[model samples]
Target: MTESVPPRSRPGPRRGLTERAILDAALRLVDAGGAEALSVRSVAAEMGVAPNALYTYFRTKADLVAALGDDLLGRLDLDAALGDADWRSAVVRLAADLRATLLAHPGVVPLLLHAGFAGPRALVAGEVLLELLSRGGLPADDTARASYLLQTYVLGTVALDAAELPPGAARPDDAARTAERRRALGGADPALLPRTAAAADVVAAYNGDAQFRWGLDRLLDGL
Candidate 1:
């Protein structure tokens, strides 16, 4: 009698694409098509695999997005880029590099805000920043606070830079929206918003990069 053929087994782990490969594919999808375009199905399609395949690597969309953000952070070399610069210059350059990375991968900026950095290079950046702080004679508490403030400023700035508004939508029509929003807030009841109503125009002025720098400088100066 002819022997029955045994069932074929699935490929082992070494034969399949890695978790890192899956994340890299996901990041590419986000980079090319924006955050709204990234779904596990879409990434799987991009990778020429089954939709359910990515679930084994990234259990959920949020988890995948977080992993992509972490991967992007791994690509940055802030401490190395600074070379032998002084603490202030090194910190400033690091902030600029961080901003550039976010802009280059705008789809991941929101993810970064929600998840922060997690990979090895991110840890290196932090360690070097702290070491520089110690070298610059900062007390531990102040160093910690300064690092927090600097990162917060960078993240907030990049979030705004990556914003997407609907087509044909004016950017809040500054003057009109200021007056409209002010009236909505307290409708000619200046007492409820004395300073705000009196300074309606300045409210719109408070939302751009110039203001971002101005605010960051004020905080840095306070240190």
Candidate 2:
């Protein structure tokens, strides 16, 4: 006595999509095409599913990006790498490892910059560092501040390392940037600029790895 429902009017396949699978596929997309290529539709296409299906797994794109960031960080096995190393050496190795990973995935560096350190991997890294510092006899306050200082330095270093020229952009060498500024201020003509250009090489040489290590060592010793 009621309108008949068609047999085809049944629930669709609930068999393939899962949160882990979606996140895993999203990670691969990011790794292969870079973070910019990651979108709900792209990931869904990668998984051969409807874009709306991903919404069930990740409420929003930010959630998916954060998940990808956490997965990326979890790849680093800091504890195993540390392996009885002294706290100072362990910290340095951690910094180097983070720098290497971030540099390798330059596309994802922006994700880290925007999100900062909020993922589960970040929390674990912070906790491990805190424990190591505490065991090394640093007071609670100093240990916390040192942790902040170390993380900030590492993030800034990675960000600088990932910098690149924008599209169709011609980045001036140091002397050029400086010369242009000087010219705008009516300080000197192009002739004076050539003389100052030679100084750029000295500045560049002074900012090499040796200088970095020197500063890092001195700072750590004070800590």
Candidate 3:
């Protein structure tokens, strides 16, 4: 979408301008072109409605983004994830579900990066996490701390994955990653840094389900 995008004006208040409809329109724009492509005018153009029509549902582009973030969070099936008998299994299931959501809508990841998902839907997810932590035998303080650790682990991993892999890119930043790895390891010489040299290739590879699970399980084990 261009900066000069023009709104598609509709007569009057554009009957049936529900909040859900407006959110749906915004979500499509974000999914197609990421957060930077989202704007009041751009969404209006996508929805075939005047820019002002969205103001009834969202006060600004920021408002729309937040609502969309919460909407996405609300999509997670907390009960299904928590259905796992053990707390560790439940946490893994919940985190996995969240990761899937973030990967599916890579556009919304930036919204979480900056503004954060602090709305009602976000609160619901938080509540579920806290409950799971509490049930895992953590005291009040440990539960709060564990909640932070688990949430940060999930969000940070997803954010890093989005930045490194991106969407619709083959061999994403392969050269850049190799160059960075070389700089960090300084040749990883087998004679001088044999251990580093042995695992250098592993550290430079792309992360996927196995990597994600490995890190998540380690964090849970530490807890």
Candidate 4:
């Protein structure tokens, strides 16, 4: 009976795995091919594990996607409390960080577009934003409204920025892209677009960071 023992089979790839590891692997897949590239099987193969192994961490792909969104939003570094006079700077910093994070992972932007915001990370971020808005002297109802407005602007800006990026893949090319934007906008009918044509040069100079900050300032001023 002792001699009849067969050679031991290789262990499966489930050990040393954590939910964070699974999310990281899944995030890599999203980075490669956008959110549509994500699937339980794809993520399992990505981690060199059985597809069912992923189920241990995430019961379904939806859970994985939702967690991915949370993880991305959770990347924001927020101070616990902002000084009264620093609310403006705090708001600007938060918006800039959000914009930068989304642009850095443009592939994941679609998940935000479709799912809106959810999960603990979003709640945390919301808590901070509400506190900042309150500090800025907005009423409770207006604070809530302004939070939605700010989130919508950041997400929408990221979506448009991602859409306009050149297709060979990834990152910024400000001068070149700005030149290209000028060329693209050059064909406008000056006859009908007199004002736009007059300001074409200014309009063509679309700097996302400067423009985002400028807009955020306006929104805060209004609030």
Please give the CA lDDT of all the candidate structures: 0.69, 0.69, 0.78, 0.80
Residue lDDT tens for model 1, 1-223: 9999999996544346688888878778777766677888888888888776676678787778777776777666764645755766666666767777767677767666776777566777777777766666879998888787778888887787567433222244335545565555555457787887777655655544455567766766676
Cα TM-score of candidate 1: 0.67
lDDT of 3 by residue, 129-209 (tens): 888877888898998899889888888978877775444332334466666765777667789878877787667543566
Candidate scoring better on TM-score of 2 and 3: 3
Worst 10 residues of 1 by lDDT: 165-174
Which candidate ranks first by lDDT, i.e. highest?
4
**Candidate 3 regions off by >4 Å?**
1-13, 165-196
The TM-score obtained by model 2 is 0.69
TM-score of each: 0.67, 0.69, 0.80, 0.86
Tens digits of per-residue lDDT for model 2, 25-46? 8766766766577788999999
> For model 1, what is the alpha-carbon lDDT of residue 6?
97
Query: Deviation in angstroms for 110 in model 4?
Result: 0.9
Instruction: Please provide the root mean square deviation of candidate 4 (C-alpha atoms, Å).
Output: 4.0
Best-matching candidate per TM-score = 4
